[model samples]
Target: MANLDIKIREAELADLELILAFISEKSEFDGVPHLLEATADKLKQTLLFVESPLVRVLLAEVGDTAVGFAMFYASYSSLLAQPCLWLDDLFLQSHFRGMGVGTALLKSLARIAESTNCGRMEWTVNTGNVPGIAFYQKQGARILENIRLCRIDGDAINLLAGQ
Candidate 1:
């Protein structure tokens, strides 16, 4: 189709399979879990949240294929009295790296946040992820020297919810 183009749009239920493929492929490359034990139904549940104003997935497409995606969730800042977008995940396949797709995705997200009056946009990268660090620096994003990120994932959250 000559009219087909590379564009960004909200991810949908139909994108479940393709998005999972990207994550699994990246996980394999990063020596992490390639499969998350996720099913289409489970993905649908997740999509419900993402489709809401509180969360969103922006798909980067080329032709009929999705080459990259950025998953973000909205957070509130009590001090700023404004919503903040916490970028939960950003990924582009190796073949597409250095082509400015990642930057484009991030800039798009920033623009969205700005449009919505959100106070902050944030995410973290592993210290060993050199390219990521460099890119963030080049974008004028600050790298806090002494700060550390803490996480509680998997069964820990369930355990807390049980209380």
Candidate 2:
């Protein structure tokens, strides 16, 4: 599928709804639909209305059909003493899989990181998602065995704010 008609472009404010739909689809495909809390309004506020936006979205299309998207943000790497790019989400439609859509999205991100002088690009995959893990590995990404992801959200986040 190297000759696939995949074109990756930076998302714009007009793509809010499309991006939200893609996110929902990704959550459902990953068997976590109940965890999807994104909506067009919220996406507009955070992804478009903010003064200093925290995220950048890249959309992949094939002849006007939206196939996938990658959402990322900038971060700092203390050890490297340089900027890093954190890929929060990368997803493609089921039919688009194995057609190099994912690879194109990742490669575009790598180029963006390089252009911006980012030291590293990072993202996490679900442990049970074997295919996803394998894809990353095949792309020369190392799966760190010792590091674990932690987060606070929902009521816990509110409680922490109150304290």
Candidate 3:
């Protein structure tokens, strides 16, 4: 941590291009490049102009250089009747990995969760991503073996909604 001067800040509309580049790199790194469909227009619409926005983004910079980003949103746990800070994505450039960037990002997210009175902060790691799993575990996160994530999107999502 001493070797790098890292600062975490909320992303602004002016940082749209930088944020999109990070998202693309992250998608490729995670082996899901095909899933990345984010555009500057969409980001602007959802993150900048939307009223009562459901998502927020954070950027991590190392001495004026943007190295990573984290996108998150709030969720509610019906069973616990408490809010949760859901980390949708956390990614740092390959060169920045193992240099405390990921840890700093998680710490920042934890701070946000605590400040918001969230019951918990949750995120998912790919099963094949050993290093990511290890990093989360190091931060005292538990892997829910019993839980499986499901998703409906694209055509299915619209069809189900009678679109």
Candidate 4:
């Protein structure tokens, strides 16, 4: 891994174009068109959501290029009675891996959480993603065992629309 001169900074509207491009490019590798689910208009709404703290995006810049990014939202757990940062998406281009870009991005999130007095930082990585799981372990993040995630997206609701 080369010495990555990475700068971690909060993203701005000007970053939307690059973010969209990176998201579009990465979907090809993951075989997911998830970005298609987030049009520009939706992103605008996310940044302005009043019910929740606005989703924040952080860009990892290497020299003059943005090689990675992360998007996250904040939430509070009534049971825990504390706030948490829910990481939604994290991506680093293949060429930038093994150079600490991911770690830097994660650290930035931790800083945000600490500065905001958050209680936890959490995210879910696919089980089939062995490398990602290992990386989280390396970062001292333990998996929450015995917990399953249930999701209801547009498709599910669309199917039950007539019911």
Candidate 5:
């Protein structure tokens, strides 16, 4: 691929639709499109319009064409006594992969983590995404072994809440 001028910037309100599209595409790429239930309205309420939004998004563009996005949130590491940047999602279009757009996005995130005095940046990779794992490893991330992610939502959340 040619040397593309990849621009990474924080998402603006005008880019709401673009962000939603990227989220959908990322979900499809992860082979779990059926689990996606995010709507524009929900995103607006929970992420965009909130006074203190927990999640933030960075959009990657090659000129006028948006090629990818990275979504993340801050979490505290009690053990380290510092904040951690939890990368919730990072997705680049198939054509944009290997063109350094992903690397640029990640570099931007690392800057954010550094500026905010984060102890570390953390994310999980799906076992099936071999290429993604390799890419992350190339960026100096190590995959932790013998750790499983657990989740509870929907009815389970309600049941646990004693509803």
Candidate 6:
């Protein structure tokens, strides 16, 4: 049980494949592999090539091996009149779980939020993921039971737009 020196850093364009692999692994872990439609081209265009990427990614590695990633985006809270950091995804390899990698990633995100003067940081977790919920609770995140997530995408978006 040697100490693992985990290093967290902002993702670079060269790490595209590694990021995509982590994303696919996360989707599979969430039991929705079929819903993972992300391609390298899409990731490159949306996350790397954009002038001002709405979404940013952070990678966690132990030495030369990548072990986890956290994807997040900036959001606005009209009521608070301040920016918010919305964590889109946080995933660590199964072997790396409970090894402080997740905590390291979260602490990094918190630092970023504080540095940017964000009003809040938010993300959703599946109710079925008890371990994940517990881990998040340990990290001082409150699980909001009253709020429900809403989404409209794919064909539904077109219909909503009256297209």
Candidate that scores best on lDDT: 6
* Candidate 2 residue-wise lDDT at 12: 88
Candidate 2 lDDT score relative to the true structure: 0.91
Please estimate how well model 1 matches the true structure, expressed as its whole-model Cα lDDT.
0.78
Q: Estimated TM-score per prediction?
A: 0.82, 0.94, 0.94, 0.87, 0.97, 0.97
Which of the predicted structures, 3 or 4, would earn the higher lDDT when compared with the native? 3
| Local accuracy of candidate 4 as per-residue lDDT tens digits, 1-163 | 6786899988887787788777776676566775466666667666633355478889999998999889898889888899989998788998888789999999999999999888999888888778888988999999988888888777788887853
Q: Candidate 6 lDDT, tens digit per residue, 29-61?
A: 999999999999999888945898868999999
At residue 67, give the lDDT of candidate 1. 88
Preferred candidate (TM-score higher): 2 or 4 = 2
Error of 4 at 143 (Å): 1.5
Candidate 1 lands at a TM-score of 0.82
Q: What local distance difference test score does each model get?
A: 0.78, 0.91, 0.90, 0.83, 0.93, 0.94
**Model 4, stretches more than 4 Å misplaced?**
48-53, 158-163
Clashing pairs in 4: none
Worst 10 residues of 3 by lDDT: 45-54
lDDT of 2 by residue, 101-148 (tens): 999999999999999999999999999989899989988899999999
Of 1 and 4, the candidate ahead on TM-score is 4
List of clashing residue pairs for candidate 1: none
Better of 1 and 3 by TM-score: 3
What ranges in model 1 sit over 4 Å off? 1-5, 34-37, 48-54, 158-163
Which pairs, if any, clash in model 2? Answer: none
lDDT of 1 by residue, 6-113 (tens): 677888777778877776766765567744565665666766444454457898876677889998878889999999988878888877777777777888899988
Per-residue lDDT over 54-104 for candidate 3, one digit per residue giving the tens place of the 0 to 100 score: 689989999999999999999999988999999989999878988888888
